[model samples]
Target: MTSIYYIQVEDRNSMDGNRSNTLAGLKNNFAGEKEVLVFSNHATEITEKYAQSGVKTTIYQNDAYTIANFDAVLTKLKQIFRSKTDYLLVFDNDSLGSSLGSRIAALLDITFVADAKKITETPNLTVTQDIGATSAKRVIPLAKQAVITFSCNGVAANEPAKVDVSSWSLNEQTKQQYRQAKTAGNGLAFAKVVLAGGKGLGSQQQFKPLMKLAQKLNASVGATKAVTDLGWLSPERMIGISNLTVKPDVYYAFGISGAVQHTSGMNKSKQVIAVNTDPEAPIFKLANYGIVGDANKVISQLNDLL
Candidate 1:
C-alpha cells in the first residue's frame, strides 16, 4: 500500500516529538512506500526530522493555511494527494487529524473509517474494532482506496536510513477567505494539568469557579461536548470523540459521567482526579482519586485553600 500521513504543526519553533511514533506506526502497520506531509509555515524541522527518521517527507507551507481554513487545506491536499495513494492515515487523537481524514475521504470519494483500533493485511486490508463491553470485534474489509484515523499507542517505532525531502508552497491566492477565531483552551493539548467539566456541573456559571481554579494551578480548562453545545464553554474547549484529545500529567474531571466518548480523550492521563455526585459514576473506574461530592463545592473549597 502507498500511504501518506498528515501532521499539522502550529508552532514554527517546535514540533510534537510524539508524532514520530505515529509516523513509524504507519510505516510498520502497512507495507508500502509511506510519506509524511508536514503542514506548517516552518516545516523544515519536521521535514528533516521525519526524513532522517526514514520516511520521504513533503512540506506544505502557505500563509493562508490555518486550521479554520478547511477549503484552502482541502484544495491544497487535492492538488498533492488526491488519487495518489492506496491508503491515507492520520492520528486519531486530535480533532484536526481525524476531521481531515473524513473530509478528505469524502472529497476523494473513497472509503472512510474513524477511530480504528487495529488494522491488518492477510494479503487484503482489514480493520478491526472491539465491540463495547463484548468479546466479539467488528471486522471490515477495506476498499481499494481508504482513509483511516487510528491510535498509535501499541505500534512500535522504527529507525531507518534517511530519505530526501521535497517542498511545496502556494504562490497564488485562494478565492475563499477565513478569519480565525481566538478561542479559549487552545493550550489544552499540551497542558500539564487540565480541569474539565461536564453537564453534571449544573449550570454555565459553575464553570467560573473551575476556570478560576485552573488559573490558580496554571492548568488549561476543558469542557465536555454537552457543556460546549449549551454555550457554557467554547467549542474549542470540548474534549471528546470528535474534538481534542489530551494526555496531561494530571487530569481533573469535574462531574463527568465517564462516558466512553469523554474517557477516550483523557484515558492516557498520568493521574486522574474525578469529582462527581454519584459514587458509582463511571469516571471513578478510571480515576486515580475519586471524590463523591458536588463539583462546585469542591472547587470553592480548593479555591479557598489555594
Candidate 2:
C-alpha cells in the first residue's frame, strides 16, 4: 500500500497570500497519493483547481483552532490511518500547522518528523531537515505509521494539487470553545506602523534592536525573504513578492540591501524610510527618507532615544 501525503490548509482568511503556490513544494516532491484537507470557513477557486490536479481535497466549515478539537481532525486522521496505507504530511506553514499540526502529532504519538527540508526515495524514503540557515541538515527515514511536518521554505510550484473537494461543518461544542478561546488581535494587516528588517540585520542577536524598536512604537515587525529563509525570522513576517505584501502607514527598512523582490512587497507603504550603509541601494529609490549609515549603529541610537 502506498503511503498517503496530506497537506493541511488551516486558515482560509489569509489564503490570498499564497493560494497560487500553496504547498506546491511538498506536492511536487511527494508526487503520490496526495490529499489537501482545508479547514476553512470560505471557499475559493483553488478548490476546483485541486480537483483538476487529480488529488483528494477536503474542506471543513471552521477555522483551524476549532478544527484541532480532540474529537475532530485528530479523530479523522485516526480513522484514515486505520487502513495502514494512509498517513499525514503537513508543512509547518504559517497558514497551516505551525501549532495545530504539532499538537495532533503529539496527541497521536505518530513518529513525527519536524523541519524536513526534502524527502528522498532510496528503496526506503529518507527525510532531510535543515538545522542551520546556510548548510547543515538532518536526515530522517520514513516509518510505517508516521506524521510529518515540513517547513514551507522552498519555492512552491505553480501547479495546484490535484484533488476533489469534501466539506465538513463545525460542531456546536467546538464553536463555543472557539468563541471562548479567541482574543483580540491587531496583526500585521492592521498595524499602522511597520519596522521591517532584512538579512542585513546580521544575526539573530542583531535582530534584538529591531524588536525593541517595534515594541517602542507599537509597530509590527516585517522581514525580507532572505531573513526568513535563513531561519532568523518566521516565514509569516516575510515581506516579499512571494510572501507578505504590506502597506503600513509607515514602513522602515533597516540594513536592507533592497532587492526588487523584497522592496515590491513594501512599495505601497504611505511613508517609506530606508536605512542602509550603501547610498545607492534600490530601497533608497523608493524611500521618502533615506539614511545612509550602519544599520546596527543607527538602530542602537534610535532605541536609546525611544
Candidate 3:
C-alpha cells in the first residue's frame, strides 16, 4: 500500500524540519511499500531534493492554490481525490498540517485521525493517538482509507537517488472573487494600541470579551502562541518569535502568563498593562501596570466603564 504525505512548502522552514523527519518516519513505517508519495504545494529546492532522494514527488501549484488560499487549495484537493476510495494520506500534526489535512478529509468524506503517535499493521492497520489532552490513548482502526496527522521526533535523512517530479495544476474555473474572513494585517506591527490575550482566557467563548474590547478601543487584537495553538484566534494574530512582532505604544495583556515566545514579540511596546488571576504570573514582572484579578472580570469592568 502507498501513503501520500502532504507538506505545506511555505511552513517547511518555520516548523524546525519536522516535515523531513515525519516523512522519514512514514517511510520507515511503510517500509517495502510500493511507494511513499510526497505531495507539496510548491516544487521548491528542498522538495525537488526529495525527488532526487528516490521519493515519488508531486506538486500542485497555481495562483488559485497557494498556501494563503485554503479554499482554493481545498477545492483542488477534493478534485484530486474525488474518485479515490482507498488510500492513506499523512500530514504533520502541526497547525497548518492538521488544519489542511482535517479539512481535506472532511470535504472528501474520508476517515480522519489526528495527532497520531504510532502506526501498526498487525491484525489490522491501526493508529495509536493521545486522547483528552494527552491524558489517555486510543487505537483507531484504518479499515480501508484514512487521512492522518502525526507527530514524531525521530530523524531520518533521505538517501540520495534519482526520481521524477510530477506536477499538477488546477483547472481554472470562471473568474470569480473570493471574500475571506478578516485577517490580522501589517497594521498590527504598527498599531498604536494592542489588546492581546493568552491561554488564561479559559475558553474560546471567554476570549470574545477581549476581542470586543479591542473593537471598542479601536486597537488591534494580538494573541499568544498558546491561544493560536488552541484555535481561539487565527495564526496571523499570533505574537511571538517566528510570528508577528509588535511594538505598539500601549499593549494590554489579558490572562497572559508571559512566556518568552510571546514577550519577545511585544517587548518593544512603550507601555505594558497586564491582567491575570495569578499574582505570580511572569507577565507582571514586565508590565508597567498590573492587575491581579480574573481577566474576564477586568474585561467586563473595562467594557462597562467604556
Candidate 4:
C-alpha cells in the first residue's frame, strides 16, 4: 500500500502561515514518494507550490459551500478510498475541516487521534499530546488508514516553506441538524484584549458587569467551561479544549481558578492577569499579575476608573 498525506485545509481562500509550515514538515517527513491530497469546502484555490515540490497533487474543492456538514465530507472521503491504498489524514487543531475529518473516520470505523502536539513517524507513528503539566504519548503502527489533528505550536506547524495548491467541485449532502444562527464574534481570534470569566462567577447577572468593562476597554469577553456549561454564557465565548483557543495581547481572568483545561487554550497570551479571592488559586501561578481579591469588587473599581 502507498502512503498518502490527506490534509483538510480551511481558510480556503488563502493558506495560513501556520498550516503552510505543517505541509512542509509532512512532506519532509514522508518515507518515500507519496501523494499529497488537499481538501477544502470553499471556492478558493491554493498556490502552485505543491506540484513544484516534485509530488503529485490532487485537490478536492467543493464547487459551492451549500448545506455543508461532516457527513458531506465523509461522503467524499469514501469515494477516494476506493482508488487509494491508505491515507494518513491530518487536520489543524480545532479546525472545522479537522472536525469533519474526525466524524468521517468515526463513521468509517477507522482509528483517529486528536490534538497531537508532536508526531514522529520512523519505525512507527508516535503522537504526543502535552496537556499542561502532564503529557500523553501513543504509538500507532502505520495503519491502512488513520486520522490525526495537529496542535498549533506543539508540532511546529510554522515551517519555513510554502506549498498551497487547490481547485473546485460540487460536493455532498448534510446529515446533521441545520439552523442559521448569528455568527459568533471573532474576538478571541482577533482581539488584542480579552476578559474571561470563570466558574467563580456566581450568576449570569454578575457576568454583565465584566461584559460592560470589556466593552469599555474595546475588548472581547470569554468564559470558562463551567460558566458556559451552566448556560450563563454563550459557548462561542468558551476558552478551553474542544472550544475556541486564543492568544491575545492581554488576557484578563475574573473569578477563574485557572484550571489546566482552560489555561491550555489561553496560556499563549502575551500577558495574563488573574483575579480571584482565593490566594491558593492555580491561575496565579501562570498569571503575569495576580490579585488575591474579590473579582466583582475589582471589576467595579476598574469600571469606575475607566
Write the residue-wise lDDT of candidate 1 on 1-306 in tens digits.
645564444333222213444555556666665666666655554454454556666666654444455565566777766756566555444566677778878888888877676778767778886687788888888886777777554222234545444445444465443333444355687888899999999999998789756644656889898999999988888997878889999999998999998888899999999999999999999999999999989999986664
Clash number by candidate, in order: 0, 6, 0, 3
TM-score of each: 0.53, 0.52, 0.50, 0.48
> Candidate 1's C-alpha lDDT?
0.70
Q: lDDT (0-100) at residue 150 of candidate 3?
A: 80
Error of 2 at 115 (Å): 1.1
Best by lDDT: 1
lDDT of 4 by residue, 167-284 (tens): 4444444333323232344435677788999878788999878865664464678899999899998787789876878899999999999889999989999999999999999999
Angstrom error at residue 105, model 1: 1.0
Candidates arranged by TM-score, highest first: 1, 2, 3, 4
lDDT of 3 by residue, 1-306 (tens): 534544544322121112454566676676534244433444454454465334565555343333445565577667767886666777778666788888988988778998898888777778898887767889999856678898754334436544445565544464433333344443577677899989998999987777656644546788999989999977888998968889988999999999898999999899999999989989998899999999999999876554
In model 4, which residue pairs have backbone atoms overlapping below 3 Å?
Answer: 21-159, 47-164, 63-169
Q: Largest TM-score belongs to which candidate?
A: 1
Give candidate 1's TM-score.
Answer: 0.53
Q: Candidate 2: where are CA atoms >4 Å away? A: 10-22, 44-46, 52-54, 61-71, 85-88, 93-96, 132-134, 152-162, 172-284, 287-306
